[model samples]
Target: MAVVFVITLAMLTAATVISGSPVTLTLERAFPTNHGVELNQLRARDLLRHRRILQSSNGVVDFDVHGTFDPFQVGLYFTKVQLGTPPVEFYVQIDTGSDVLWVSCSSCTGCPQTSGLQIELNFFDSGRSSTSSLISCSDRRCNSGIQSSDATCSSQNNQCSYTFQYGDGSGTSGYYVSDTMHLDTIFEGSVATNSSAPVVFGCSNQQSGDLTKSDRAVDGIFGFGQQEMSVISQLSSQGIAPRVFSHCLRGDSTGGGVLVLGEIVEPNIVYTPLVPSQPHYNLNLQSISVNGQALQIDASVFATSNNNRGTIVDSGTTLAYLAEEAYDPFVNAITATIPQSVRTVVSRGNQCFLITSRLG
Candidate 1:
């Protein structure tokens, strides 16, 4: 459920050493300030996006995430990505909950021309980029994607293509292409240098649902997941950057934060063990405690398995969702802890309840 918590958003997902310099990109809040209706829609869509990823994901990749406690306002984050030899800038959603990086392409059906975020959206033209090459189905990455149910191809063209249908009915489909991903790497933890690497990403040819609308549109989604096709994994596989990345998000009036592809070594940092051998960043949740009181729910309900989905920390999701068993009890405890005097009113298209008082 949606709760007001945290100001600085930080997270680390997996770690490694980079012989070469790791890159840093400009990260900022993607939504406009004071747009209640649009913000609600954005959160609703992100929740559905994570649901689809958690349900369909077959493998797991490791990463670390750390965030300072603050009132996390209504906004999803994005990063600036430069692609092709000429380096066209695109604003892509920063999502750790899913894998693969994709962007709208030329001749895309239903892709929005304008964005409500007021960013100039540019489409990736594979034909225009001399370094761009269409990924074949026979490629190992395509096979890996196929095994994970992330890709497919027909005998006629042999092009590796993929599709995702979100829980909110939004969907995107495109083919894979190999091209240059430009970056500004930090050298020796001190110097900044320009560099580039070959990366495989999506070229969206179609879009549906909210994705086709301009209100919350973006160039594409940059996923930080545990898939072989993920850009972060690709970088880690090489000596360019580690699998881990860090960000400090601000939902304030002046919205900007850090999004860097490097290790975040903070003093006295505590690490939480991720649930072993499961796809998605599943956590071994033992129980839920509200204030000084614990909920009367069994811990087994939070368990993850081949068929049963468990609790996960999704960077893309604006709210936390519990399984059916733990949901009621947890909600009960939260309701009990909070004063009933605080009214919960439906706002922004009935997407969430606006609470007037702080629950401490």
Candidate 2:
């Protein structure tokens, strides 16, 4: 289901201490003021597509998501990323749903040149960067980071090509490249220092579906999913940044938010351990509740096993979804508390109560 929830997580590593100072990135709304409801439709469509993939496949890798946030929608958040030796800036959607930082490259077929968010869209050219280098399929980094163990590599010079398909039949195909990525880390109260680090990212040579459109397109996506190919994993592996990161998203769409790398020195913050070895941030869900009323269901429904895909907390999705067996009982119990006179109306494909007046 397309859920619009924002959750922050802290990923800790026992092997090494965090090297760099904390960095802060500003998140800009993908859509400007007066964006319409069509944003929800687009999100729902994408979420529906993603659900099918989840049901069909388990632990999908080598996937690079296209422009994550809708350029014409108000809910999606994005930022500008400066990369390469000459320091070219590219607008990328900051997503917590997936891993791998990728952008459209020069001469990419069907890639949009402009965005509706009033930003100058530019394609990444490895030739322009003096420090840019191709990552071959034979490289250990490619094998460990983006490729599966069963994947084969021919030679050291063989370019590591990747094809990322989205749920909506949209995808981007490209090769891997590494270059310098710049970021500003916050040192102390409003004082920040600039730093640069070498990282691997995708250079898309072709794109299809929604990525080819300008209305919801940007440079590419900066995924924060739990994967080895993610920027967090690469930086942590190189001792440039910590394995931990946190974000505080504003509820208001127009107001921007903060994405911080490393520990957040804030008061009254509580953290829990993350489940190891899962595609997303897999968490053990205890129970479900509505208005302080916990649902009366079998504990096995919330159980996690080797085959059962448990609960995940993602900031990129637009709606919350429940399993079929869990959904029926939850909905019935919720409607049980409501008056029979209250009619039901369908809104955006979801059931809504049509009460004549507010009755809380």
Candidate 3:
């Protein structure tokens, strides 16, 4: 169960606000290479001209999402796609670090019986709707093997499946399948009566993980990674060039960020100064310094490699878990700052100290 607590939304909002920017993030198609793939950097000012803000409650925190609707959008829960077929109305986390868009299948085991945010089975079963199908092994979307692990594959029919492991000791395993998706258009405070966009997506059929069991209501997840099969890529192939997404987290649980697509409202947003690095197209963090001290950590700790070059910056993950070397200095700095009276003994018989603070 990869379902995140609504309370976690607060942390997400905080992270988004901290990583502020109005720069245009670029995406490009690439060919596999031993070193790393390359991406096309399109100017942000040229692609985005407008942005819209939406508010939705995830049974806990109410956050904002900034995105557009000229093209369709996909939402996810527990690594499953929440809205796929017609009458698709559900909240989704617009993630840039992921590539798969999936929703819990109709026959999912241990799924909650409640119906509101879950996928509409009637719409999926309707003759008007396209049937969900599995991805073939030959498809480029299928993983050749698990990224950054000893996992290797020899099967030609390795169905579309994902094994998502999270920092919170939670994860999910499921096969990916495709289905038709729909989205309604709203313009200038009114729903466009004649506007509806159709989309294709990969819905997860099976799900099992810690978060899934905890947040039984979560149905699936939507991946927005820099890959050809992602929902963004799908839209781009259809001539929805230069799609953009921006999130502005709320100040509190009641207020969240917006997930915008196609364009952004530059005038209303604040832009962060950009630091150019090797154009992995992934957000690069040269280092993390708290207060004023630079913590010694592995540079790779700040990034995850995709196509040897792209690094995914995930706001959903909590705790700045730096590479092992960096963690030591960070821990030492914190320990040195705290008074001994508030420190707790490390449980592993290590010299590490855990301190509790009482802020007044």
Candidate 4:
């Protein structure tokens, strides 16, 4: 659903505090690395892909997951996930904006078999896995508030199934199943522990919109949300991982970064509090400044209310959506900070411009 990105999730636990434990994952950018394609051309496609991802706020991470940034193709980053007994590997998009991890299942209706990305896509065959079990409505995990909101019980078999509708006519529906997920846990500073945990995830039967298309399709999505059903929470509940996870993009062109299951403490690191009673990782934006000079915009402009939405840290989206009212001042401050002679246009391929829109 379009509001899936805006839906409220569970409260955070103190377990997120920096400690010795974390789960690490390797990631790959969902960009097509075609040497024949023009860089700008790929950049243009990046905007289109980004728009499709958002136009559909929209809808849509992580053990110590790290990813590469594709300069030519800027899109969602994906990671290889191992599920089932024999452990079928699947490439799933990493999303912090939405809850629930799902993959295209065998006998799927509209799941994409192949993807435009360099990697091959794999379907989750629950029927083949000896350890796989359907999650019934009466199951304790199925009765969670978040699961109950989207999941329904089938009278015939008491199966717990769900249908998530998105505003852009894009959505996914499937049944709940419990399976083994293999992970690499990070201990001490860098020690790695190979591990496995039982997690409840979705076995997608159908998909619509951009999801059904192969251009950017993958096995499914891996959600790092703070819900009982999310892999992150389930692992935390099992004492296999911490509830709090942190993500960061590398400063290099590769756009690579870290997605750790536990907090990472650094010297002189700035700390910010999560807004209480708000969905997602909501943050109180006290101010905005360019080169030490504050933008002449009202602090209230960033405030979240019952009607007006505020700021939340969402990793699912590649671009930051700024409010129209706050755009000019923010841009003006940046423009003033930069020398007039500085090149604003980079061969039309790397042109930089602010994106303005309303988010509610």
For each candidate, what is the lDDT? 0.73, 0.69, 0.44, 0.70
Per-residue lDDT of candidate 2, residues 190-243 (tens digit): 213357788888888899987798875789878787677888888778776667
Candidate number of the best TM-score? 1
- How many clashes in candidate 2? 8
- TM-score computed on alpha carbons, candidate 4: 0.71
Q: Per-residue lDDT tens digits of candidate 1, residues 156-199?
A: 88899999876568889999999998876644322233578899
What ranges in model 4 sit over 4 Å off? 1-72, 145-150, 165-169, 189-194, 331-360
> In model 3, what lDDT does residue 6 have?
19
Q: Pull out the clashing pairs in model 4.
A: 1-165, 1-166, 23-64, 24-64, 25-64, 69-254
**TM-score to native of every candidate shown:** 0.75, 0.71, 0.55, 0.71
Clashes of 3: 33
| Stretches of candidate 2 exceeding 4 Å from the true structure | 1-72, 146-157, 167-169, 190-193, 336-344, 347-349, 353-359
For model 1 the local lDDT of residue 265 reads: 47
Report how far residue 75 has shifted in candidate 3, in Å: 17
What local lDDT score does residue 355 receive in model 3, on the 0 to 100 scale?
41
In the order shown, what is each candidate's alpha-carbon RMSD? 13.9, 14.8, 16.7, 15.9
